[model samples]
Target: MRVGLYPGTFDPITIGHIDIIRRATALVDRLVIGVAINRDKGPMFSLEERVAMLEAEIAPLQQETGVEIVAHPFENLLIDCAHDVGAGLIIRGLRAVADFEYEYQMVGMNRALDSSVETVFLMADLKHQAIASKLVKEIARLGGDVSKFVTPAVCDALYKRLGR
Candidate 1:
């Protein structure tokens, strides 16, 4: 089976992220949204909370496509996780040039590890091109609305965490 692995910190799993996963689902037999565990970054939501929020956001799409959203607490390496999941394609969402620079390097390293593995870059919708998890959290913390950028569950989680 051709499985596409969409991996990211998903600090909160924005709508933009969801759009990419949704589109990727149509292109692959299986889509696994891998939530990378970054200890240094210090997650806004606890790993459990983030996973729950992601599950809620992607549940509908999973129901539609037989896809699944699961959290893989990855602190070691991306290639290791990909190999563990038997992913042949790495799905990444590109919002702008900044993301390209980072993703390009990752693609090269991933390819080096497994020449058969390929990275599939998907462009974010123009509306969400600049949306990112950190920015969303910052805006929400300052009492700015980010409901348009993130899912309802994520919005609620942010507010609850911030005591808003």
Candidate 2:
């Protein structure tokens, strides 16, 4: 069915994520937004909260974006998650050289786990490349507005989390 998976911790989904989803939808029949579970890195929002935020953020663009947004807690190996969901392709967005370095290693690791599944890398739209969850959180944490880069869902969650 040409299902593609786009997985990340998504501590908070950003405009970059939405942009990737927008682009990935064009190349595959369906896109599964897999939310990875990080055991070591503590997140501001709970996994459930992050998923809810993602769902709300994507609601308005659900029809217009032409991508199905589904969040899976990738507790197991990511390849297994893809296999479980019948994803033959993995879509990732690259923002810069550093991102490529990290993602390249991940791509290799994913391939080692499942050679049948291919990782497809997409360059982030220039305007959205700098919009990262960590940066967004940092900005919000410091009381800096990130309205242009984050969706309303994320903004609300950020504000709530920051007690603003």
RMSD of each: 1.2, 1.3
Q: Which pairs clash in model 1?
A: none
Clash numbers, per candidate:
0, 0
lDDT of 1: 0.85
The whole-model lDDT of each prediction reads: 0.85, 0.85
Q: Model 2, range 72-118, lDDT digits (tens) per residue?
A: 77778889989989999999899999999999999889888879999
Q: TM-score of each candidate?
A: 0.95, 0.94
lDDT of 1 by residue, 31-103 (tens): 7778888878998988787788888888888887776655566655788788888888889999999999999
With a 3 Å backbone cut-off (N, CA, C), the pairs that clash in candidate 2 are none
Q: Ten-residue segment with the worst summed lDDT in candidate 1?
A: 67-76
